[model samples]
Each structure stands twice: as C-alpha cells, then as structure tokens.
Target: MADDETRVDAAEEKPAAPSDSDLFRQSEIAADYVEGLLDILDYDGDIDELVSAGRPVVEVVGGRLQALVGQRGATLEALQELTRLAVFRQTGTPSRLLLDVGGYRANRRKELAAVAKNAVEKVKEHGEAVRLEPMSAFERKCVHDVVNAISGVESESEGVEPSRRIVVRPAD
Candidate 1:
C-alpha cells in the first residue's frame, strides 16, 4: 500500500505544462522592461509583442528607434541581450525572445537570404569555393540556413568576429 501511495503522490507532484498565459506573461514583462529603456534614452517607439514563429517577439517601430538598432545591428543585439537578461531576472529562466527595431531585422534577413543564394549558385556553377564578406552572427545563421537547404553546396563560417565570413563549397 505504501509503494502504491508513493507512486500516486509522485504523479500528483508533476508540474503542469506551461500555458499561453505563461508565454504572454513573459511578453508583458519584456514590454515593460523595454519601455523603461526607451524612456531613459528619451526615445519614441511603439512596442508590439506577440507570439511569432513559436517564440515571443517584440518589435519597436518608430523613427527614433534607429539608435537602438545601431550600426550593423550591434546595438540591437545588445538590447536583445539586455532584454533577455531582464526577463531572466524576473522569471528565473532564460528567454529566447526576438526583438526587432524599425523593421531592420526583417529587411536584413531578406538581404542575407539573397546573398546566400547568390553564393550558392556561384559555388554550383563554378565548382569552386566562394567566400562572402564578413557578417554578424545572425547573418551567418541566415546564410547557414540557406546553404543547408540547398543540395549541392555546404557553408561554414570562418575568421573572427566583425570579419567572420561565410565560405561556400560544393558538397563532396
């Protein structure tokens, strides 16, 4: 009887799955944190939060959000890290939240995809390796994805940060 009771107690102690409420709470907390940041910088932007692509995504859209995005999206990446840290502080769990400003990430992603495809074609046509200009980690990821999707070419990142480029070679 004690063994059976122990099994029943263990089942009762199992935690429930995280519901949509849990996800939305994360977004709300993130929005508040970002709002404070904008306030401190005297920046103006509209914050929109929602579940996108199965993850929490927040976008700051406005003219003044440019500084937040920074050159080559460096500031934007930093802001993303700070936001994740804020979320972690509140929830005690790391977040995979995506933050976009002034539609920069969306536009950049499109451009990166094009660059990757072009490199892919070059590798296929010439049967030689193609080296692309250095790109950020996000950009490298986009290129890696495109190359992975293509059949004849493989891509890898070489070099160091701020100069890390993608090398595309024909798959052996």
Candidate 2:
C-alpha cells in the first residue's frame, strides 16, 4: 500500500542499531589487538574470542600465564580496557569488552561469591550493616549480584573508586 511504502521509506532514513555481526566485529578487533600484545610479550597462550552477555569476551588459556592476571587481576583488567580501546579505535563505539586469562575471572568470581555470602550471613545474623573492603568495579558488581538475589538483605556500593566498598544490610 502507499502508506506502508511511505512508512518504510521514512524508516530507512534513520540509522539502524548495531547488528550482531557488528558486535562480532568488535571481538575480532579486540582479539587481534590481544594477539599482537601476546606476541610482543613472547607469551604462549590460546585465545578464544566471542560475544557473550551482550559484550565482547576474549579468553586466554595456558600454563604459566599467571603474570597476565597480576595481583588480584589488576593486569587483566588493564588489558581488557586496552582491548576495548582497540575495538573503539576501529569501530568508533565504546565497548564493554571482557578479557580473562588462565581462568582468573572464573576463580575470582567464586571467591567473591563466597565473600558476598559471608556478608549476607553477617547482616542476617546481627541485623546490622556489614561493610566489605574496597574492591574494583568488577568485584563490587559480582558481590552486588549475589547479594541482590538473597531475601531480607541488600547491598550498596559506597565511596569512590580505589576506595569504594559494599555494605550489606537488612532489608526494610
């Protein structure tokens, strides 16, 4: 019909959202960047790139790659940001890319989950707020997700970066 044709024509004038293939391209760029870094560092690792959780993820698995993780994943986090920048430079889009080396993130998530559970327990038992030590944004997010799932308890992030912490308290 004429009306339908008109609508289609008007819609075509507006830019569309990024498609799945565009997102996949971001991962490809990030993977290439990471591979170059690995070559420069003379590190041996297997890289797998994919899109997950609506973001690009680059996973590196190998032995003796603990140095890539740094102390408490600091180096890994920095690497992720750098990869994201590489993606952005090519795509002109900011990315929420995730980079994991040697199962570090998986291990850290399990450990942080335990810490969150402990905080939930303390809040429930004492009916008082329990404050956790300062953590990176990723760590705080993991803790928040765990605590938010439990009933009668809640968690909030306070303070600024490098000093920010989570506080678990009884729900109202």
Best by lDDT: 2
The model with the greatest TM-score is 2
Q: lDDT of each prediction vs. the true structure? A: 0.87, 0.90
Off by over 4 Å in 1: 1-21, 159-163
The residue-by-residue lDDT of candidate 1 on 24-127, one tens digit each, is: 67777888999999999899999998877556778889886788888999999998889989988999877778888999999999999999999998888899
Model 1 root-mean-square deviation: 4.5
Query: Alpha carbon lDDT of residue 30, candidate 1?
Result: 86
List the candidates' TM-scores in order. Answer: 0.82, 0.88
Q: Residue 56 error for model 2, in Å? A: 1.0
Clashes of each: 0, 0
